[model samples]
Target: MNHLRLFLLSIVVLTSANMLPAGDWPHWRGPNDLGAAEPGQSPPAEFSDTQNVLWKTPVPGRGHSSPTIIGDKVFLTTADVAAQTQSVLCFDRQTGKPVWSTIVNTGGLPREIHSHNTHATPTVACDAQQLFVVFNNHESAQLAALDLNGKILWKKQGPFSPEQYKFGYGPSPLLYDDLVIVAAEYEKGYIVALNKKNGDVAWKIDRPQISFSSPVVANIAGRDQMLISGLGKVCSFDPKSGKQLWAVDGPAIATCGTLVWQGDTVFASGGYPEKETMAVKADGSGKVLWRQGVRCYEQSLVAADGYVYAVSDDGIGYCWNAETGEEMWKKRLGGSVSSSPTLVGDLIYLFNERGKCFVFKTNPEKFELVAENQLGDEAYASPSFCDGKMFMRTADSTDGTRRETLYCIGE
Candidate 1:
């Protein structure tokens, strides 16, 4: 089916369950990439490396990607550095026991990546029946579909060369309807949608140089548009035909975070010193409502209750009024932050690179730090919250010492 038809069909499927209670963190940045959890709930405020952890599973290899939890299963990807193997690991959500591990076919090539980058930066997405994963092996990139039981259903490899960045490919794939959207922006900047059932090309559009940011799907002006940021530009496109609808230039920093949207306004930010954050009106014509500069990177924005919250890569957290682009307040967080901030009710949870997480109030007038905890390692992967628990992953240190601990933080 074409993308338009698939989108229409998905609307039907989604509406029937719209009223049903939903709480699965099935992909990056949670459901719909909004970063808002269920209201009136929070992660445990006082958990150390060993305390308040319901379970800790040692994942194999190394990866900075976050975990995606559905129903009773949790899915993530990791790279075997010495063996040159890329695989997906599935674990039981309740017990943290290994269910299965599927080795992905990376073709015949030596895996080339930055020392800090891995082959598993993209988080997997899934529906009720199947799971999807993206593997970039330097020479080529491939997207694979597998059954819930680990059987490979289909695989599609790209004919274009892999794009080289200071880091590796960090853009995760987004699934909309029956198509899987993957951003190949390095050697050749393009956004292509593949048939989810058979891995066929549904639509492809060539784009300019963009950074390692993922694309988001949203309803703009009664039409469905894919929002993407990179190459000093934030643009929207028709998902079915890849037609550019509108765009606005941004800062020079490589865009590495998800865009946050509330009603008709979309917010994006990146860069150091003076990071640029803008609230653009996505009303089919793409107008800038307001723009502000803030220093943030690699961290996605979270919107809730008319406020947008973000933590800078240098460890500063700020809350902004969503409608008017007014700064509420800013707080100086002491650790470096790479993961995004997730809002649960009136509280904001921020996980930092130094293995510390800070809990603060999501107030619009001032800053309030409620609690702080440490993990005793480096954390690059964002936390996944589901069923009143937060899942966190950390990077291994130098000297070949691997630490693939998955901590389940709860009360």
Candidate 2:
């Protein structure tokens, strides 16, 4: 009888572990970049700077990169303007306390950046043991790998120093298997994959023009390929060999964020010459099944069920049919927005530049606004969802004071 009771207890433990909801937003656009979470879960209907926020932790310096959560820890990067320092910060997910900060002082290089840009504009990606961060200083573009406890494992610097736009490096790193891939589409356009363990060059492919978009991994037609978008084009490359598989040209402007893949279809959106959104068949041959011009800049598209949800840089939200490229609904909101929309169950969350967040229903037939909340600051960085909590960061103030902070919104 005792043995049977113990066996039953063990079974219950295993089942509970497997049944727990997957809420960890480990990367830029959450797990796998689909931006859709498991159904039946929803964030709080109303949250503000003072209410319903689980914790608000102060982050050093200013950066536009979003926060990535792994296990019980959250990781982000920032740049100290006057100090000319780039640092990666770790926070305790549960208590919102600072864990450790690893500063990389790349001296004299940040002077070349635009006044609005910073040394840290890219978010860090981490697996179990290592975190990958990208820093674009004035003279050097670098990617570094650090341990969870804040030890630098390896660092790699780029050869070319190109003039960045008003914003610095907005391309975040993507991690695959044992490699950290970087889209260094600057003066010398190259997509380089480094061995994640030791920072050795695994594969590098050169392109014609530099872009600000990050690379996305997709399994198309029974093979894995990295889909990257840049100035006037989108292409897929063999992830292992860095060989181009297919290319489609004519994107109006520079790509800003990562592409989202759904089934065999991928959605990409950006703004420079206005907003252009398209859905390409990920057949491993880079075929365009259907393309529609939905104007959005700097905002990544999120697909859920049968619809694609997007927010324009100017703060307009739209829902469209993912299959037919038909517009469903469009609504104007409070302020300008750049963070991607996140779908948690049937609710879609959108955050704007002035730190206002709007929640709406995910129904494809209509636009149902639910709640609008504010954080009392500016938010240029994207919001991340993990462990039933939403993490967001505010931009810095104009007085060179770091008013940026990380907020964990949850029950």
- Give each model a TM-score: 0.90, 0.89
lDDT of each: 0.76, 0.74
Q: State the lDDT of candidate 2 residue by residue for 37-114, as single tens digits.
A: 533445586998778899999888878878888778889898777777889999999988999999865465544554
| Tens digit of per-residue lDDT, candidate 1, span 183-244 | 87765667899988999999988755636788887775677878977677778888777788
Q: Which residue pairs in candidate 2 collide? A: 23-387, 109-138, 185-210, 232-251, 271-297, 275-295, 275-296
Q: How far out, in Å, is residue 178 in model 2?
A: 1.1
lDDT (C-alpha) at residue 136 in model 2: 78
> What is residue 339's positional error in candidate 2, in angstroms?
1.3
Highest lDDT model number: 1
Give, for candidate 2, the lowest lDDT window spanning 10 residues: 12-21
Best of the candidates, TM-score:
1
Give the TM-score (vs. native) of candidate 2.
Answer: 0.89
> Relative to the unseen true structure, what is the Cα RMSD of model 1?
5.4
